[model samples]
Target: METVRVNLGSRSYDIALTHGATANLGAFVRAALPKTSSVLVVGDSNSWPHAESIQATLTRAGLRAGSAVVPAGEASKCLERLAGLYDALYELAADRSTAVVAVGGGVIGDLAGFAAATYNRGLPLVMVPTTLLSMVDSSVGGKTGINHPKGKNLIGSFHQPAGVWIDLAFLNTLPAREFISGLAEVVKYGVILDAAFFAYLESNSHAVRTRDPGALLRVVTRSCRLKADVVEQDEYERTGLRAVLNYGHTFAHAFETCGGYGTLLHGEAVSIGMECAAQLARKLGLIGDEFVSRQTKLLDALGLPTAPPTRWPADDLIAVMRRDKKAVGGQMRFILPTRLGEVKLFDDVPEPLVRTVLESAVSR
Candidate 1:
């Protein structure tokens, strides 16, 4: 197992990455949260078996373990499902010590983590992210929330998990489109922070696409550590440093919201959003065609979309973007790239330029 520690003083935790099956999940949980006596495993329908296995392991370790399963999809991250999760916790008689293990993708993490954060004023939380997207990004950030009708992640909290357990075996079961969707976030890390890593992805694209164990290990390990470095500096968005992680999210979230949840996967929106942001950056003279070409080539090689779905009209997307959390005082902000390896948040973006990017939606 490879371990990356998120050093956040008292809120610090370890992200454990393993290739396939492993024993001693109980030990992993106990090591980080010895005080926990019981656990409520929250998973979606597709990941229930993994959740069942986790519950049995924890129960065998002499801790009470229970599980709740919701239908698998973006729709699951809603007020109705969140209320159901609260009911599950109450039925399990879970307390502050009874850790909530989010077993599945990003949706489960957000739903369960929100419950753990609010129920009984916060319960110990453990993340068992089974999807590549959640494994590399959402699982490590401690930013948990359910989506509201108006926006994505509109209701949430900064409740860090006690530990994160990642087993890449889950990738074997993920659909091809879902797996490709995940590469978008992986690409975002390279764009916003690591130049070498971007070049590495370009060179080793075949290996990662083939699911070579070594490439995946390096990819997930590096992505988690890069995020940890940022989260350590600004656990909340107070310092504006963490906002860089939202590089393409401003446009992406709007795409997701306008299409309604599940129309486009989160990472797909991120992929298209990155392209829009890059185009907007070019208009602002932050970078030229070369920078945009590099990102477009990588996104294409990974089978990600560079433009929002045509059905998502520019005006509708604009209205949604305006209501996005990143828009302060009804003004838009974006994390635009200065070059290949870094991104800067700009609050002075013009609406017409953004509209042009949205209206153009021409895939390279």
Candidate 2:
């Protein structure tokens, strides 16, 4: 197993990336929260089996462990599901000493993390991400929350995990579409922070899509390191430096909200969002035509959507963007790429230009 550290002083944690590390999960969590006497293993429908297995592993390691499963889908990330988690913890008689081990994808990780952060005045969290998206992105950030009707992740908190335990073995059963969906965030890391990672991806797209083990290790490890670097600098997003990680999220969240959460998977929405953002950047003369084509081709190669999947109203999308947390004075802030390896946040974009880009994104 390879380890990367999110150096947050006292709140620091380790991210373990390996192909078959599930057997040691108990030891990992035990080391992270040694005082914990019990664990609440949370997962969704698709990942329930794995959650149960993890429970057994923890129990064998001499800690009391129980498991709960939520319906698997984006819709589950809501107030109702969150309340259900709270009830589960209550029934479990959990306390600060009981670690909440999240055992599925982003939805479960976010929901369980939020529950761990709020229940009994907060509990330790150990993430066992079972999806590519969660492994490289959500699993490390300590960003926990559910979705709101108005926008994505509108209700959330920053309760960094005690540790993030990742095993690429979890990806063995991941669906093809879901696997493809994760590449969007992987691509985002390249577009926003590292050009070489982007080049490496472009060169290894075939291997990545084929699930080559070596390629996946590089993909997950590099993505985690890049994200950790950002989180280390701005743990609570106080500095605008962390916003660079939101390169396509403003447009992506609006797409997700307008789709009523499940219509477009977060990765699909982000792919489309990056397309619009790239177009907007070109319109502002920050990049040339070649750059836009390069980005679009990469997404296309990854089999992710490059345009809105449906005809969401441009005005409505903009309205949702305005309500985004990063917006200032009713204006949305966009993380626009200025080059292959760098992005910048822009808060002064004109509504007309935004409208034009949104209008241009219509699938047909």
Candidate 3:
């Protein structure tokens, strides 16, 4: 097992990664939480079996445990589902001493983590990410929240998890498209932070596509370490340092919002968002066509979309971008790559330029 630490001083925690790590979920929970605390295993419908197994393990370990299953989809990450979770905790008589075990994808982690953050002031959160996107990104960060009607992640908090347990076994059951969707974030890490990691991915793309265990370990561990380093520096995103992690998210969130949340998966939108950002960077003379070409080739090889879907209008997409969380005073802000392994946040990006890019991205 490999361990990566998010050093938030008082809120510090470790992300443990290994094959079949879920089998040791009880031990991980025991170490971080008190025996007196009860555990609420919040699972998504697709991952309820794993949740049940975890609940059983926790019960056998002498901790009071209960399980709640949320439907599997982006829609579940909303205020209504959150209220349902609150009701579940209330009926279980859970209190501050209760810990929420999020046993599914990013949606589950965000929803359950938000519940843990708000319930009775706060409760401990244990993230057991069942999806690649959750494992590499959402699960490790203290960022948690349900989606709002206006925007993606507009109603979230910076509540860090008590422990993050990543089991490679979960990937075995993930749909091909879902698995491919996650590579967008993996590619984001390489684009904004690690050129060598990007090259490694390019060379080992086949291994990664096949879900080879060794490649997955390296990918997940390195991705977590890179993100952890950034989170350690900017836990609450107060400083501009953590904004680099949103390399393609500004555009990605816009795509998601314009698609009405359910039309496109988060990572699918991210894949196209990264391409658009790269194109915009090229237009701004920050990088060359070769840079865009290389990134595109890699994304194509990985079976990820590198162009915007035709369903959403370009103008509407730009409007959504203007409302992104990174926007200030209604001005658009973007994390654009200057080159592979580096990016910088640009504010007050001209609306005309953004519109032109969006126009070309969707039409292509």
lDDT of 3 at 348: 57
lDDT of 3 at 324: 82
Model 2 clashing residue pairs (backbone): none
Quantify all predictions' global Cα lDDT against the true fold.
0.90, 0.90, 0.89
Give candidate 3 regions above 4 Å deviation.
none
Question: How good is model 2 by TM-score?
Answer: 0.98
CA displacement after TM-score superposition, residue 240 of candidate 3 (Å): 0.9
lDDT of 2 by residue, 5-83 (tens): 9999989999988777688888888888889999999999899988988999999988888777899997888899889
Candidate 1, residue 283: CA error in Å?
A: 1.3
Q: What is the TM-score of each candidate against the true structure?
A: 0.98, 0.98, 0.98
Best of the two (2, 3) by lDDT: 2
- lDDT measured at residue 58 in model 3 versus the true structure, 0 to 100: 85
